[model samples]
Target: LDNNKFVETRFGKQLKPSSKSTTYDDVAENYDGQYRFAPIQEAQVSRAMIKRYFETMYDRAISDVVIVGAGSAGLTCAYHLASTRPDLKITIIEANVAPGGGAWLGGQLMTPMVIRKPADRFLQEICVPYEDEGAYVVVKHAALFTSTLLSRVLAMPNVVMMNATAVEDLIIHEDHAGQQRVAGVVTNWTLVALNHDTQSCMDPNTITCPVVVSATGHDGPMGAFSAKRLVSAGLLKELGNMRGLDMNRSEPAIVNNTREVAPGLIMAGMELSEHDGKNRMGPTFGGMIGSGIKAAHEALRVLDS
Candidate 1:
C-alpha cells in the first residue's frame, strides 16, 4: 500500500498520492538523499578555459597566414584556406576571450542574424540551418550558427586559434622594389592593451608571416595601423576627400575588390571598406564571407607567383 501511494515509476507508472500530503521538508529531504550536489568553482572553470587557449598560443608561435580578427570573415577565410591549402599553417588572433566576434551575440544579443539569398551557399556548405524569408535567409539560431562555424574552423588541423590576444603593431619591411610590405605583427594580451598598461608597449611578442589578412571588421585597426606606417615611410600618399563616394552604392565593389592594399598585407571583410574608403554594409553576412573567400584565393595566388 505504501509503495503504491508513495512512489512513481518512469515507465508511466504513477502511484496514487498518499493520504498524508508530502510536505516541503519531506520532498527536500528526498531530493537531497537521491542526488549529491556539488557546484563547480568559478576559478576552476576559468583556469581550464585559459589553459586550453594558452597552450595553442604557445605551440604555434608562427603561421603562414595570420588572421587578425576571428569574426565570420576571418573564420571563413581560415576554413577555406585550410580546405584548399592544408600544408599552410593558419593562425587566428582574437582580442576577445571567446571567438565569433559580433556573431556570437547577434545584434546586441537580441536579434537574429540575416544573410542575403546569395549567401545561401555558404550556409549550406557549413551545414547551418537557415530558411528563406523573402529577400534574405535568416539563420535558425545566431549562437548555433556562430558556434558551428567556430567548430568547423577549430576542427581543421592547420588552424590555430589564439583568443584574448590583441594585434598591437605591424612589422613592415621594404621589399627590393622599395615598397613597404607587412612582414609580421606585434601582439600582447588583450587585458594589457585594454588596461593601457605601459608594459604592453614594452613587453610584446611578434608573429612573422609572409601574408597577413586584416579582417579587423569595419574599424580596420590593421589597415589604419598599416596606412600610418606606409605614409610615414613615404610609400603611400595621403588619402584625399571621400565625401563624394556613396558607401551604400559601393558595397558590390567592396565585396569584389578585397585585394592586397599593401605589399604582403591583404584586407578582407569590412577592412576592405576601411582600406579603400568604400561604403559600409550594415549587418551583411554575404559580403563578409565572400570577402574572406576572395582574400584566401588572392593570398594563394600571391603565394604561387
Candidate 2:
C-alpha cells in the first residue's frame, strides 16, 4: 500500500469498540484496556505488525523507524521489518538492561510475585523446573528466535541496534515550501554500566529522519508524543469529555502537535488507558501487535503515495 493511497488524516476511521456500556466497575467504566488469558498471542500480533511498518517506512524514504522500548513492541517491530525488508534501515533504543519489557514485568504473566490460581500453576510450569514448555519456550523462543533474526538482520547493511539510550527531544524540518517536512530525534544515554547502582551517560546526540515513528513504549519526556494527545486533551475541553491517554498525568501522551515539531509522527501500539478507552484485549500484546500492524499498514500507505 502506498502512502498516497491513505489520507493524512483518517477522519471517521477511528476504532469502534465492541462494547460501549460504562459499567460501574472502574475496570470497565472509567476506561482502560486490560484482560486475562493472553500473552504469547500479543507477541505474535506485534511481530506481524512491525513487519508491515518496515516496508512502509522503507519505501517512504524515511531513514529510521526508531523504537525506544525495544522490549516487546520495539523488538517485535524491528524483527518484523528486518525479516520482511532487510534493505530498510531500522534501529531499536532500549533503556533497560535487556530486551523484552513485559517479559520481565513480574506478575502472573507479567509480575510473578503476586501469584493467582492457574496463574501460579502457569508460572510454576514456565519457571525454574520448566515443566510447561509454553512459558519457557515462549521466552526461550523469543530469545533464540529474536537473536537469530536479529543476527541476520544486523548483518544486513541497513540495520542499527542501539541499547540503553534515552531519547529526550525531537528535531522537525519542513520541506516542499513548508507543506511537508522531516524529523530528527535527540537522545542522551549511558553505554557503560560502571556499577549496578551508579553509571554515567554520554552526551546527548541527535538522529534525524524524514518520517519518525515514536515507539518509546511509555509516553516519552513531555512533548514528543503524537497527534492523538492534543486532540484527546484539546477537544475534550469543549465537549467536556477528556477521554484519551495520560490517565493520571496532567498531560496525555498522544496529542496533536505540528509536524515541524513532530514531523509525520504517527503513533501505534499505544494503550487504551493512555486515552479514555478500554477493551478485554486492551493494553495486552494483542492490542499493540494489532496497532503496530495497523500503524505499519498506514505507514506503507503513506510511503506508497
Candidate 3:
C-alpha cells in the first residue's frame, strides 16, 4: 500500500474510499462512518414525499372538470365522466372528509336513502341492493349505498377525490369572444371555516378547470357564489325563484331543468332548484342521479363545442 493513500476500515472490513479522495480526513467528513447510508436514504425519502405532494397539487390545479360536493349527483357525474371520457381529468371536491353528502346520513342518521324506480338501473350497476316499496325503492342500508357509489367513483384512474375541501368562490373569466365563463374555483380546507380558527377570512387556493359542476346540493356555496359573479358581470339576471303553484311538479321539473346555467358552468341535483325555482323534492335520490347524468351530458356537450 502507498504511504500517501489512506484506506478506511469499518467493523473489521476495508471500505472503498470516496472517488474524490483516498485520505481518511476527507472520507470522514464526506461519510459518517457506519451511518453513511442515513443521509442518502433521508434525501431519497424527502424527494419522494415532495414529488408526490406537488404532483397531486399540480394535477388538481389542472383538472379538466371540478365538481364541488361528492354527493349522489356529484359522484354519479364523476363516474359517468370517468367511464365515458377517461382522457379528461376529473376532480370531486367534498367539504366533508367522508364522501356521499346527505346519502350517508339521509334526513337524519336513522333514515335510509330512498331512490325511486327511475334510478334502479344505476343502483344495480353500482351493485347497491334495494327493495321496491310501492312508490319508491328503499335502500336497506344508507351507509352501504353511499360506500358503493363512493368506492366506484374512487376506483376511476382519472377521477381525483378530494375530501375536506370546500369551494369558497368561483373563477370567472372572459373568453376570446368576450363571453363571461366560469373558469375554475377557489377552494380552502373545510376545517378552517368549521373551526373558525382564523382571525380573518383566509384566501383560498384556486383550481382551474374549463368546466365546473355545481352539485353542491340545496344551499350549496357554488350556486350562490357563481350567481353573485354572473349577476355582477351582467351574464345573468337577478337570481329569483319561479313561482309554481304545484309543488308536486318538482320531480320532473328538477330532472328536466338540470343543465348548464352559464358558459362552462352546469348545475345538478338540488342546485338546479336554485337556478330554475324547481320545488325541492326532499330526499329523492332518483331525481338527483338523473340530474347528475343530465349535467354530465351537458358538460360533455360544452367541452366538445
Once superposed on the true structure, which residue ranges of model 1 sit more than 4 Å away at CA?
A: 1-59, 105-109, 196-201, 220-235, 239-250
Q: Give the worst 10-residue stretch by lDDT in candidate 3.
A: 6-15
Encode model 1's per-residue lDDT on 1-305: one tens digit a residue. Answer: 45545444221224566678866677668676554346789999999888976676676666788988888878888878877887998988888888887776546566578777677788888888887888779886678778888887877767888888888788888767876778877888888766665544457888988898878765433334444444565656763212234434655666688788777888787656655667766665777777888889988977787
Q: Count of backbone clashes for each model?
A: 1, 35, 0
Candidate 3 Cα errors over 4 Å, as ranges:
1-51, 193-201, 220-229, 232-234, 241-248
TM-score of each: 0.75, 0.48, 0.76
TM-score of 2: 0.48
What lDDT would each prediction earn against the true structure?
0.74, 0.42, 0.76
Q: Where is the poorest 10-residue window by lDDT in model 1?
A: 239-248
Evaluated at residue 249, the lDDT of candidate 3 is 77
| Clash-forming residue pairs, model 3 | none
lDDT of 2 by residue, 8-90 (tens): 32111223443566545645433454433335777788888787655543443346555445544354445455545555566
